[model samples]
Target: MARGRKLDIEFCGFGDGWEADNKEKPESGPKETLPPPQHCLVMQREKRRGKPVTLAGEFFLSKEEEKALLGRVKKMLGCGGTLKEGWLEVQGDKAVALRHTLEAEGFRFKK
Candidate 1:
């Protein structure tokens, strides 16, 4: 009870043989399905700093799916790209190439 002094204490009457038995793990929610081919994805080309970049949108994909798709597209195109506000931004005017690539993956595009 003194200033900065530790008190000797003992806890009892709680049964010494008690053990925790939480073994079951909680399950995660179901994964989301990507949009079907009938849903058209929108693609647009824009010029930034005198260079062209393609923006692919309207896929209605989750964040993980978008990141994975961006990775695959970047690898396939051998160029740098990023995900911005749920849209895929590839570095170049790759509208035609992106259209073919996404079409191969069963995705439709706006005419």
Candidate 2:
């Protein structure tokens, strides 16, 4: 069960000159475009405590971009991974698959 109540209220007005400060201004110029970074990423496999892990290195991504890319890779590969210092470590030997996936995402790899 619920109860409802009604109350009478008058208009609520802001103080003077509010519209002048709150008005939206149009942008003046077009945003400048920048080229993508040139990072020759590499994928290698390493053994950690009797387990295999794939290390993708040489990424030039910001912290937020690294986290997002790591999440996307984990989802696409159906594996768990983490972002390390300049490396993305996935819980498996997924170098080849990771290469293919990264290539699709406009990433280049070093031999």
Candidate 3:
């Protein structure tokens, strides 16, 4: 039981010594676990205007990650590229070169 102002009510156990005995036990729950690391990378080629354009097929990454990867690919191939709808679109065809780079980076391409 408690009496006095709201603040006093909250601090009722103060200085009484009996307050220490009235403390409530904290509740506990299961701990969260992180997901496993991703493996394997997808590769696909798209043709536009009667020409083949090689692009990074699957792009599951944040904006910063996407930007970094796009830059790396463009620099390695000496070409221009864009990140669109979670896909990396590089100008011209560089599928073989891109595949080699991805494989060297510990990612296996699917066909």
lDDT of 2 by residue, 1-111 (tens): 346855544454555444556678775455332222366788889999999999987676766777878888999999999987668899988888888887877777777
lDDT of 3 by residue, 19-95 (tens): 55567876444423221134445667888888777777565566666687778878988988788766678778888
What's model 1's overall lDDT? Answer: 0.79
List, residue by residue over 1-111, the lDDT tens digit for candidate 1: 789987765564446776567878664565355674755789989998999999887666777777788888998888898987657889998888888888887788878
For residue 20, model 2's alpha carbon misses the true position, in angstroms, by 54
Cα deviation of 33 in candidate 1 (Å)?
6.0
User: Top model by lDDT, which number?
Assistant: 1
User: Which is the winner by lDDT between candidate 1 and candidate 3?
Assistant: 1
Rank the candidate models, highest lDDT first: 1, 2, 3
Q: What is the TM-score of each candidate against the true structure?
A: 0.65, 0.65, 0.58
Q: Using alpha carbons, what is the TM-score of model 2?
A: 0.65
* Residue 65 in model 2: lDDT: 74
